[model samples]
Target chain A: EPEVTQTPSHQVTQMGQEVILRCVPISNHLYFYWYRQILGQKVEFLVSFYNNEISEKSEIFDDQFSVERPDGSNFTLKIRSTKLEDSAMYFCASSVKGAITEAFFGQGTRLTVV
Target chain B: AQTVTQSQPEMSVQEAETVTLSCTYDTSESNYYLFWYKQPPSRQMILVIRQEAYKQQNATENRFSVNFQKAAKSFSLKISDSQLGDTAMYFCAFMKVMNYGGSQGNLIFGKGTKLSVKP
Candidate 1:
């Protein structure tokens, strides 16, 4: 079955440096999302993208965070300056339809900021 | 806003026994979707099952089934004849249907319940 695919299974970056996480959603999917889970914490929603623009975002998705669909197939999330608290597992997901359709998740990218 | 709650933080079951994980949600929207996702030690999120709020007939996938009570706002997952492979952290999530401009599909997830199956 087709699934969401994320690049760089694991990444370690400096506290003040920038990092980019990339995802390639299923070809036919229309909706995409980004979520993160801190160690021993609940998975928190970051943002959702559709039609090549941000559809919605959470408080956790502040100015430092940005998402782009540079190419038709590639969706990327960029963090301007990483912090120690930013360390977590970031997941990329997509659904064929909107809310009612079941979303499929990628095998997360583990981001470690030191 | 919609919220999903998984009261059980951890649970254990014998290899051949049955286990149930509890989940409750708060949502005013009559049309929505509920899902059960499994994350094993590998930390890969896998969709185990899903149920539509409007469907009265509980959804079942082999040994896995759900008891969805629309009136009580409850959706629970039951695993029968559990196997060691079933050991994982299970999360219950809720999604509200929205078509408003600039606001669309997003999932509100619970804290998750860690389940360990003893051999």
Candidate 2:
């Protein structure tokens, strides 16, 4: 089965540095999303992208965070000046449709900011 | 806004036994989707099962099944004949159906229940 693939299974960055997480969603999927899960916490939705633009975002998705589908096949999330609290597992997911269709999740990129 | 709640923080069941993980949600939308995702030690999120709010009949996938009560807004997952591989963190998620402007609604997940299958 086709699955979402994320780059850099693990990343360690210093505080105040920038980090970019990459994801290759299923080719046919149109809806893409970025979710965050702090250690020992529930997964929280950060943002959803469709039609090459952000469709919706949660309160946690502040100005520091940005997502782009630069080449139609690769979706990327960039964080400007990472904070210590930003350390968590970031998941990339994609789905054919929103409601009934299930979202396929990547193995996740564990970002650890020191 | 939709919220999913998984009351049990941790649960354990003997191998070959049956266990149920509880989940409830608060949503005013009549059309929505509920799902149970399992994350093993590898931390890979795997889809265990899913239930549609409009479906009255429960959905079953092999040894995994769901008891979906749309009226009560309750969706629970039951694992029968559990095995050692069943040990994982199970999350309950809720998603609302919205097709306006080709935007699919985001998923709201609960805290998750850590299930351990003992030998």
Q: Score the docking of each candidate (DockQ).
A: 0.62, 0.64
Instruction: Locate the minimum summed-lDDT window of 10 residues in model 2 chain A.
Output: A95-104
lDDT, residue A60, model 1: 98
- The runs of at least 3 residues in candidate 2 whose Cα sits more than 4 Å from the true structure, single-residue gaps closed, are B99-103
**Distance from true position, residue A39, model 2, in Å?**
0.3
Give the per-residue lDDT digits (tens) of candidate 1, residues B1-119. Answer: 78899999999999999999999999999888888999999887998999988789999999999999999999999999999999999999988766452226678899999999999
lDDT of each: 0.91, 0.91
Please give the C-alpha DockQ score of model 2. Answer: 0.64
Native contact fraction per model: 0.68, 0.60
Clashes found in each candidate (C-alpha, N, C closer than 3 A): 0, 0
For model 1, fnat equals 0.68
Error of 2 at B113 (Å): 0.6
RMSD of each: 1.8, 1.5
lDDT of residue B12 for candidate 1: 100
